[model samples]
Structures are given as C-alpha cells and as structure tokens.
Target: MHYAPTWAADGDTRRRPPLVGDEREILTSYLEWHRATFELKCSGLPADRLSEQSVPPSGMSLHGLIRHLAGVERWWFHIQFAGEKVPMLHYSDEDPDQDFDDLSGDPAQALALWREQCEHSRGIVAAAPSLDATGIHAASGDPVSLRRVLVHLIAEYAQHNGHADLLRERIDGATGS
Candidate 1:
C-alpha cells in the first residue's frame, strides 16, 4: 500500500501553518516549524522504514536522526539550561559515535524510544521561562542563552529535515515541498 509522507498531519493532508509571528517570535517560531517539519518527515513511515539506514556510509536513518536530535535537545535544554548532567539517549563518553554506531534493533522499539525522547525534549524547551535564560556551554565553560540554543536547534532540525526529505523519497517515491 502507498504511504503518505510523515510531514502530513493526516493522510495526504497538509493544513498546518508553516510558521507564525514577528522578529521577537522568530526563534520560537522557527523551532516550532522545524519540530513540525520533523514530525512531517517521520509521519507516514513504517517502523522498519524509519529505522532502515538507507544512507549506508552515513548510517543515518529517520529514527536515528530523531534519536540524535533528542540527545542534542536534552544536552542544550536540560543539561545546559538546568545545570544537570542528565543521561541522554544514545550518548556515551567512551563511544562518542554511539548514537550512529549502535542502532541495530527492532524498528518499533527504536521508533518508540525516539518518540519518547522527542516528547521529553519538547518539555524541556517548553519549561524554560524565556529564550534569554542563560545556560552553561558544556564544552566552552561559557554562558549561552536559551535563545541561541533555540536558533541552533532550529538550524539542526532544518538541515536534518532536508536529509529526511531525500531519504523518504529514496524509500518510497513520496516527495514534499
């Protein structure tokens, strides 16, 4: 059977607005749009397809992408903003590439895990009082504002969503604008 692109809220449906607001709202709007884009990218994919590493050399799949982004979001929003070294999905000091390297498993399990991580990451972003709130940069020992992190996350998601678009096309001949 044919599958609708993940970005579609309903099967073949696309009613969601792309973005909303002014200059002050740009960061949040961009982040939300990217988040929606991520959801769209993952929308109609099967569990198996979602986890399949079609990009062999890169070993990047939609599920893996979600996992990696979740870890990234947690690092920035939770650890940095909240000042806590919370454990993250697919993260490890010994194997910095663990996220990409260790993705062999049931597709359903991986997808579920990714969904959970996304929800948690969203919560972190939502809990923050403002984008101006300060967060410590783990690498630089410098202060970074939540606003900066939000922008960075938006960029990251936008880039990955592009990859997702291509990957999905390769998988099933479905395409999105």
Candidate 2:
C-alpha cells in the first residue's frame, strides 16, 4: 500500500510563539506557517473522505484542494521561478476552470502528489537567496518576484485551509486549533 508523504501532514505546529526577526525572516516564517496549516487541515482523513466533495456547487474536496494547491506551487515556484514553460496537469487553455473540476477521488494519491509538489516548491524557494528572485507570469507576461510569490502562496494556502477546516468539521466533527 502507498502512503501520503509525512511532509503533507498539516498540524498546529504553526502556533509557535512569535519570533523577533528581520522583515525577510518574518515573511518567510509566515509563509511556512500557512503551508503547515494547509497540510494540517487535511490530516488523518481517509482517501474516500478526502476525495468527497463536501461542498456542493464547488469541486473543492480535500483531495482536489491538495491537487490545486500543488499546481499553484508548481506554477509560482517552478515555472515562474525557473522560467520554464511547463504544462499544467488539471489546468487547460480552453477551460481554465477545470483546475478545480474533479477533486473527489483517491485521497491518498492526491495527498502524496501534493506533498511531492510542495517539496519541489520548497527546494526552489530555499535555494534562492532573496525573495526578490525574478520570474515572469506566463499568462500576463508581468514580472513576479520570489518574495511576491511566497506571500501570495501563503495567502492562497491560508484561505483554502480555512475552507478545509469547515469542511473537515462538517465531515466528522473533528476540529483543530
């Protein structure tokens, strides 16, 4: 049997005491906390449950959320940071909305893939010396720096994790701080 990557487990370790630091360190720490929080939101859920579309009118099951986020990380960190023209997995040119289309299925597999993507993203970010690392947004041809991507990624995860929290609670009445 396969296992989700341990790195994908999102727990409340983000609740650590605030740290006193320079601006860069503080921003980096904030991004890390959100990433961890996002992971915690889906922790311990079975494959079926993770893939279930808990919210109607939206294809955002826990599994789908994981996949979508992984894609986002790849877009911002890998493609943007490295300036590569990589193809998207669930996203397409015609119907770009398909990115969140089918998130309900194979919870373990989705989570594992998400973890792998996160690892790749983290490695790229870590190797960079400054957030000002340069890249271009493929869609807009707009300039995007590593710092901006980091902050945007953190915000994205934080928002989705909030949604995940509510969905998880609805599923099993399990809540985490």
Candidate 3:
C-alpha cells in the first residue's frame, strides 16, 4: 500500500525525556527524541521540495540531512558499536559531501533508509549489556563506549536538526523542529 507522509501535532507524537531515569534510559530517550524531531521536520513535504537546497553556496537540504543521518546511524551503531562490516552509504572519501551534493535519489527512499537505520540502532542499543561496553571508532580506530556513541549521536542529531529547522522553514515556512 502506498502511504502519504503526514505531520501530527508535536505533543501527540514527540516524546519528552523522562523526568527521572538511569543514565542509559535518559541518553537513549534524548537520542530518540531528536531522531523523531528530524523526521518531523521533513514530514508532509513532497519529493521535489525535499531536495531543494538553500540559497546558492549552501547545499543543505532536508533530503541531504536524511541521507547524511542515515549514513551516520549506520556508521556509529552498526559499524562502530556493533562491529558490522557493512558498506558505506551515500559517502566516500572521493566525495565526502555526496550525501548533500547528490540529490538524484528519491527522498522517500532516503527517508525510508533513515528510519531503518534508526530501528537498527535501537536494536543494537537494546542488545548491549551496558553503556560502558566499548567498540572501535571508525575514523580514529580507537575504542569507544556505547555511552559515547549515544552522546555523540544525540549531539549530531541536535546539530543537524537545527539545519533541518532552517531548511524546513525555507521550504514552506514551517517552524519548530
């Protein structure tokens, strides 16, 4: 069945971080909330509009963010934390910014991949015994803990969500991410 993306009210969909919780619970909740915020920013937009870049010289777009975050989710959760040997997605040393530069792919597909990555990340986190568990950092080849990964992903999403906020506003004057 074909489904059209729709945006619901913030309170209805967005999850607030728990007032009290363990460190892992708090961290994961914040990360998940930010992930939802990014998706919410892109909600209800058509494919063409999702690929619309900002004013010249700035290649930032909602579609680009979706692709970029998808790569990041896989990199940190699947490859780095879970030690999965998956091929890179929408990224390469030859074209480091391909995620933002290549707008040829369908936005719907990019969004779907991002959602899948998010689900995979959650599973990885759930299976992990403790936040102290360590994994290799893809770039530095240094050991990093699940806590670090969660924090980094949260910061990454926060930064990209800011970009998404501006991009969405530019696209159709929609505010609040």
Candidate 4:
C-alpha cells in the first residue's frame, strides 16, 4: 500500500546534515535524522489507528511510542543534563510502563508533547558549552557526558521507529521510508 512521503516533497531543502561535519554537529545531525524518521513513521494516521496496539501480546502503540519518547527526551535533557526539578513524565515506581501501557490520552496531544520535548532537547543541546559537558546519571549517580546522551537518544529513537514501522504496517498495509 502507498504511504505519504516520509520526508518533505522533492526540492524542499530541509535542514539536513552535511556529509561532513564536526563531532558535535555530526552526532546532533544523526540524532535529528532519527527524530524525524520517528515522526515520519507516525504521520498521516488518525488517533484511533495511532493508539492501536497492532502487534498483539505487546501493548506497544504509536501513541505510546510518542509518549515514551517525550519522557525519554525530558529525562535525558531536562532532568539528567540540566538537573531540573521537574516531575517525571509518564513514569512512576508503580506505573513505570505507563507511557507504553496507558492509551487513553489523545494521540494529537501526545504528539504535541513529544514535539515540545524535542524542542527543549534542541535548546539544551544548543546552549550546552560542549558535548563533553557532564551530567549526573540519576540512577547510577555517575557522570555522563552530553555526547553520550545524544547517542543514547538516537539509538532509542531508531529502535522505537522500527516498532512504529511494524505497527504502521499492521494497521494498514503501508510500509517503507
């Protein structure tokens, strides 16, 4: 089945990463690409479809993925890096999987939340002194650099985007980048 273009229309010069760039730029570029890919996977679908846990036996849905990513971005950047005293997003000791399990919220709102988190992440990255800047890992209480967080976030998006692909395909026969 046909799907909308995964990216912008032809000739639309997006803020794409160059073939060559500095370390920080390259990492951020790759991270941004994965972020866009995840969004692309979620586009052009209704709320009900986005909330559908297509792959049964695993309560994973596109809406859930969006929530999860938003939480992740906040955790890594605002909470972990910036050490903000903000409340956790979609998470708790009792309901750790709430982001992935709770599908009652509006999908549009979930997506908007994710976008906002992404914007915050971009701001955090842009304002940082350098990729080598250190942040404490909440769990381990050990120092973790901004570079490490960027790579981790990129990997997270890549893995979940794969899930989004399968979920989308199962919802409708649509597939591919």
Candidate with top TM-score is: 3
lDDT comparing candidate 4 with the true structure = 0.86
lDDT of 1 at 63: 72
lDDT of 1 by residue, 70-100 (tens): 7877787777766777776677788777766
Query: Candidate 1: worst 10 consecutive residues by lDDT?
Result: 1-10
Q: What is the C-alpha lDDT of each candidate?
A: 0.71, 0.73, 0.89, 0.86
Give the runs in model 1 whose Cα sits over 4 Å from its true position. Answer: 1-24
Please write out the lDDT profile of model 4 over residues 92-145, one tens digit for every residue.
789988998888899999999999999998999999999999889888999889
Off by over 4 Å in 4: 1-16
| Per-model TM-score versus the true fold | 0.78, 0.83, 0.92, 0.90
Instruction: Give lDDT: candidate 1, residue 173.
Output: 75
What TM-score quantifies how close candidate 3 is to the native fold?
0.92
Clashes of 1: 4
Question: Residue 19, candidate 3: how far off, in angstroms?
Answer: 1.4
lDDT of 1: 0.71
Lowest-sum lDDT 10-residue window in model 3: 1-10
Candidate 2 lDDT, tens digit per residue, 37-94?
7787787777778776776766667777887887888888888776767776566678
Q: Which one is best on lDDT? A: 3
Which whole-number lDDT from 0 to 100 does residue 47 have in model 2? 70
- Please say which candidate is ahead in TM-score: 2 or 4: 4
Q: What number of backbone clashes does candidate 3 have, counting pairs of residues 3 or more apart or in separate chains?
A: 0
